[model samples]
Target: MQHESASAMAGHARQHYQETEQEHISRSQSGFPDFEKDMPSLVNRFSFSLKDNLSSYLGSKNPFYSNVDPQKDYVWLLDNTAYQNRIGRWKAEIVAAYFVKNSGKDLSEVVGYIADKIGMAKDEKVEETIEQRIQPLLDSILPAHAVTIDLQGVDVRLGPSGRDGISTDEIAIPGHGYKDDQVITSQAVKADATTMRTHFASPKGWAVLSDIDDTIKKTLTASPIGILKTTFADEPEPIRGMPELYKHIVQKLDSPPFFYLSASPYNLYPFLRDFRETYYPSGTMILRDASWMNLAGFLSNLTQGTEAYKVDRIEKVHTWFPKRKFICIGDSTQTDPESYGEIYRRHPKWIGAIFIRKVTGVAEMDESTKNDPERFKKAFDDVPRNVWHVFEDPNELYTKVDALVQTAT
Candidate 1:
């Protein structure tokens, strides 16, 4: 009975992975990408088969890939890293990313290890094609806007929606800025895009730059399966006391702009946005490029490249708000501490405080991360202890932030 149960569980997991893959296949067939036309030819298929078989053989022999299982998931995650817009201009530059990802659990990790060992996972990067179309859904929300379409893509130019008769909720970034008088109304709409609008906050005021996974949302990044379950299967759950803390900050700042910066893919933007609207302050979302990889690839990105990715985003934000001081929030799961520290070093005067949520539930970490000291001790060693804080609970964050930003505010 015990053996049977084990087999059943494995089989169920495998089936789920297969079903998910099939669903993606169906979606592609639904005319989104015209996958049939893009399908590889017979010769290409032969070449790919040869490469895949070679990889499988090599992976089976690799000592590090001993746990290769058939039931792993490879997902393509979308990461929207940067969205550049002027304070009162309709023109906006939306920079996004798309890539494959691994479930980072069990067989997925093992396969990722093998894929990396065999050089089959060349970042699993997909090139952007000129024919690919980019569309913004909330154009009607703008009072006056024009889109220039080309074979290459479209550039969205938005003009100011002067406050004459515009409701703040209807415009992406209201000309008047968000005010207590402006309330988000739930109206029946034919397009999901109506819910989305792109606008930048008026600069020069303090803003909060926050991390998504684990810091605000309940992403179990430490566990491979935990990651899959949280990001894929579970309804996004907010970290306890986090919403209240964010509310307090926004209230104190009287509604400063916010930016949710993350390494998570752009595919999750809508998901995270829903959660944000429900519990946190509204702001621009910054995500890294998406990718499809197994667990090994996930770790490779997190360990070898995450710090650079985060630092680059932070620097860009600093460039945009050079004169504005900002609060940085992230979790201790990955390299947030180090990444934020690097940003602080470059712009010491601009970083008001760095908050790292210490993850105590998970015990295991990647070999590279295992060497790092607990919390902000080593990551922000040179920075004043008061400037950066590490805590397990969100309640503790309010006090630490108050100590730092109180006088500045």
Candidate 2:
């Protein structure tokens, strides 16, 4: 029975991973230049045969891999980069699958191991060590950027609702009432884009609100149980350039963009803190609620709640930054695109631009997502404009963000 449960868990996990890949791919606007028409041929060129053998190592334990006694010499095999690479690649594949599946638990330390071993993310400590080494050197040369300037204080505040018209429950869902061409702009969107400004005493300040699962870091292996399993195994791979991306934002922030970390729930703040301490190293976080889970069972029976939670968060964001311009980053694996689109529609004035990491899968709309697809579509369709900026890799986003910052400056 134990083995059966574990096997069942593995199957569920694999499906989730594949779905994540699909959803991520779907939201992507660009990749491989002209490869879309030839995706089948392209995929055929990869070593997919590896999956048959890879599956066993990913889930089953061997005496060799379990032989380790200490945390420091955490090598699965001594002096065998090939074995390490194979394991890393396999782990990366599974974790990436997990991200889309949302199958895992919350074992931070183990997740950290899979993340590091698989190169899911760079060691957070490395960034701190480098910063400590480089701070004095950069401080000495700071005058090169401008006149003698001392980095001073920074403050950020989340604003409240500007104009309250309809009550939260006043919003209506589709099919149940409204027409095919029906619109709910009255209750959902602001009269115009909400206006919020991130004022800087200096020349530039920038903020980034990144998605947690697959964007900045990888806990993508899903399942709270899988997360628990991999906790002691290996570190998940970090999407390449994450550290540099955060660093660039930090460098730009000397002009002091009032940064705010906004995400779907308050629980995700620790991941953001990990980002800050390791890479950006400084910023403020605008926390949001995850209370939707409390109503998950109830909401799953109805379509109203999907948009309700997202709408609630956006309204909170607008209230907090009534006049601040901020950059938004989230994945397509969840409600990010629609959420950002609605925010852009209501307060086009406040949102500078949105960068959505397209992690693929419309789980919300999938039968497997445990929600009403029709309801999900209605909420998505109601958004004023498509606010998604999809990219295949972190590097693509870094290039675009560089341009946005330059233009903003």
Stretches of candidate 1 exceeding 4 Å from the true structure: 1-92, 95-195, 291-304, 366-375, 403-406
lDDT of 1 by residue, 231-267 (tens): 4445678989899999988777657678898866444
Question: Which has the greatest lDDT?
Answer: 1
Please report, as a residue range, the 10-residue window in candidate 2 with the lowest summed lDDT: 91-100
- TM-score of each model, in listed order: 0.55, 0.39
**Model 2 Cα lDDT, one tens digit per residue, 316-375:** 544434544567766544556666667767876666667665454422233233134443
The TM-score of predicted model 2 comes to: 0.39
